[model samples]
Target chain A: MIQKWKNHAEAYLFVTPSVILTVTLGIYPILWALRYMFYDYKGYGEAKFAGLYNIKRLFRDDYLWDAIWNTFVFASGKMILTLPVALLLAVLLNGKLRGRNLLRGIYFMPTIFSTAVMAVVFYLIFNSYNGLLNQILNMIGLPAVEWLNMQNAMLTCIIIAAWGGIGNYMLLFLAGLQGIPKDVYESAELDGATGARRFWSITIPMLGPVLNIIMMLAIMSALESYEAIMVLTGGGPSGATEVMHLYLYKLLFPVSTGETMAQDIGYGSAVAMLLALIVGVITGLYLYLSRKLNDIYS
Target chain B: MTRISGRILTWTFLLITAALLLLPIALAMLGSFKTNQELNAGSALLPKVWQLENYLYTWKEAKFSVYVWNSVIYSVGATITTVTVCSLAAYAVARRSFPGRKLLLGVYSAMMFIHMGVLTLKPAYQIMVTLGLHKSVLGLIIMMTGAGGTTFFILYAFIRSISKELDEAAMIDGASSFYIFSRIILPLCAPALGVVGLFAFRGAWNNYILPLVFTMSQPELQPITVGLANIRYGFGGAVQSHLMLTGACISMLPMLLMYILANKSFVQMNVGAIKG
Candidate 1:
């Protein structure tokens, strides 16, 4: 009993800091955010204990759903477009191609551009009057676009997200593609397994584990994205491209008439918690369905 | 017949994609060379003129001289402390079969499931407010130290891959655990340490959100990331494409230097991802 107790004590000491951090910074903030969900707690001042008020307000909130809808469309669009492109690119570059290092450097270029910077760049490209994007369109005799304005806002943001992101996925796929033993291709060639058939049968199976992890990573990243949306649109021309964090930001720092920031702290915290839960569920489901959980354990 | 065609198609597809990726960065680089009017009038695949002034102006413009020093100090300070503390903790867990070790590992891992910033910035601010670190870079360093431990913990998992016999040999050589750790274990742990240090560096360097929320008054103390964002806002969006391009150039400078110097190690580190 004494030995076991001593062991437990030592274990407790080792783990204490992490436990405390997770509680104070991780778990406690979540519950705190949850509690504030019901009240109208704004950033600066006193919040009323309006039970279920914020949650109810969320249902009646049109902008909340609009943000939700935009975020969904963006996330879905990223998955479909980014993955196959990354996979194909990885497969091509996995071999000895000309300018391989230069290509790798170039392909990974946009990712190195900070999202805030990319937002400015994309904003420039999509600008109407003197923007490069409009300049090209007009040259081709197509109508010039008002990119960040209402109509093209979400679509443009999605394209930017996809562009900046695809490289990281490609790298991950490259790692997976490299992991497959060359022997399989050698043996498959002997069996008259031509290129397409070999890829379908051998490469896919060999690559399953890595591809699964990449998908999980892609999903997690998609859900967690805030910077791109924040920089690109600021929840937009009448909240057209508003996302969860952007919406929370707006709620906390409302720019409307007679808006007192301090008064809405509770509501902001509530939105924060709801957003946390929504992301948590999405990630949890992805973790479960994909090979992430099984493969993660050491 | 299809096999040859497919191979040809693959190269074409990748080349086209690579070209698309090249477009923005190439534009940003050349944009720095052009005068503001030229960039606005008509920017294309190439710059009409080369203006090294954008780089010079950006350096002075953001006072990035100070920003770079500040960023280096904070990130390095956090890196040194975080690696030491986390490696100590990780050593204890990976080497010893003490009580609650599994439980302790589970608790830390479970914390990973929570959103990265959910409770972190808020309560951290509350604590910082009390510590009077609210607007200080030291406060940012400490917060980063705490967050920085998680990535190192992932590196810790990689440490488990090495055999225990290595530790046993050191112990038999009359080395104290401390001596053995610093002398033997730590040296042998270089690859893991390298991965952790690089990760910590990239994360700390790229970080903007923490500074944005935590400190508002100290523009002098701002890092490159936040400083670049401020430049964009200061310029006012519409007609300031050159200034915006200058901001992009400034932000990418340190990262580009780091990437070029460490590209091999960087690639190796990604392949080393255990928890990321």
Candidate 2:
């Protein structure tokens, strides 16, 4: 009985520190943010009860709607480009070819750099007059394009994101590929299933679990993306690239908006709750899909 | 003949894609070593003369050394806190047959989906003010330790992979669970810890938003990422590409060097993460 009590104490002791930090830092802030949704308060002002006013204001905010639409465009654009390229790269690296490790290392290089730093490097490379892309274009006797203009701002951001992100996802897919038993491929080969047919039949089905995991992660990240957009365009070329999170950040901080520097903590929280609802839906889908995949796997 | 042709096609495609992906980095590295005159001449692929002075200028003008040290402190502090705290909790749930193990595991699993993103910023900022942790790098590290969302699950899965018999045998020897955890489990889980450390350090080092938001008024306390971003847009307004690229290169140098040294392990760690 003494030993049982000791075991319980020991276990609780081991887990308590982490639970405290997680609750204080991660969980509590979220609850606090939710609490702010019902009050109309700025940073230093008194919290006046303005029930549902923030929510009503959120519905009428065109900028918020625009930011949401732009975020969707950015996230979808990133997903559409990132997944196939990462899968293709993973497949290429999975082959028993010479210098595969070297190629893999090179491919994964971009994933390691700071996104802000990479954004700057990309900014230089895509510069309108002195950029590498335009220089190449001029050399090839072609017209130079305004890559960071309002129309192309989001596209440029997507391209930059894909360049840096493909490596991490490719590694995930490669791990999944390596887990597949070789005998499956050999038996398929015995039946004369070669190339695309073999890949479509065996590899794709085998990678389904990892694919779902990556898809969930990719969507979550693409939605939460701020650093690259902040560094590259600051959600600009005339707010063409303002994402939901960036807009929320602007609302919370309110740095450069001279008179608008009055921090609207409540309204910002309302906007954030709406975005969180979207993320929550996606998270539910991901959870449901993961359980289904686990069921299939088992 | 078809086999040979297919192999060639695959190689060609891989090489082209690799080149395309790496070209921007290559341009930055090359441009960093060139003169402004050379950059203006459009000789971007290779430097006519390696201007090492650009690095020196950036290091001094941008206060790279201070930012580098700040980043090292924050990243290392955060990584240690995460690995120690999360591994301890992971071990409890993974090994010990305790009362709340199931509940703790459920909580962590649910927390995985609630990323919270920028929603935590307002409340976190307010909390930091109340606790007097704002405007300092250590405060940011404290915030990071709290945000170990996926890291906890990854470490838990890793701890679960270790054999149960070891813990049982250690218990039979009258060894305390803490002794077994500290002496037996942690050392055995060194490889996972390395993976966690790499991730923790890299995430903190590359983190831009938290540092930017926290260190908004305190420029001197900023890390290299914030420093480089500020120089590019704020301080180094209308600056030459060579100098701007130099700052970017300096920010990337540490991770690049780490990758070069442990290329194999980095790849394995990334792959190991997903295999969980």
- For model 1, how does the per-residue alpha-carbon lDDT over B1-276 read when each residue is reduced to its tens digit? 986897798778878888777767767777777788887787565676677777677667647677777778877977775677677667767776775678767766766655633334665687778889887878888777753235646656766877788878977886666676677678888877876777677767777767666656687778776776666555445555676687677767777888888776666666555233
Alpha-carbon error at B249 in model 1, in Å? 1.2
Fraction of native Cα-Cα interface contacts (under 8 Å, chains A and B) also present in model 2: 0.70
Which sections of candidate 2 miss by over 4 Å? Answer: A256-262, A286-298
Give the TM-score (vs. native) of candidate 1. 0.89
Kindly report which residue pairs in candidate 2 clash with one another.
none
Instruction: Give one clash count per candidate, in the order shown.
Output: 11, 0
Q: What TM-score would chain B receive for each of the candidates shown?
A: 0.89, 0.93
Per-residue CA lDDT of model 1 for A1-298, tens digit only, reads: 8966764565455545545554665566667777777776555567578888888887887767777777788788888888888777777687667878877777776775568767777777776667777777777888888887888888888888889888778788888888899888899889998677987887777887777767766776776687767766677677777776666655654542122433366766766766767877887787676655556642
Per-residue alpha-carbon lDDT of candidate 2 for residues A1-298, written as tens digits (9 for 90 to 100):
9989888899999998899887877788778878988999887759998999999998899989999999999999998998898999898788777998888898899999998889888887777776778888888889989999988889999999899888888888898898889899899989999779988989988877777777888898899887788777878877899998888878887773222435788888888878988888976787797888779966
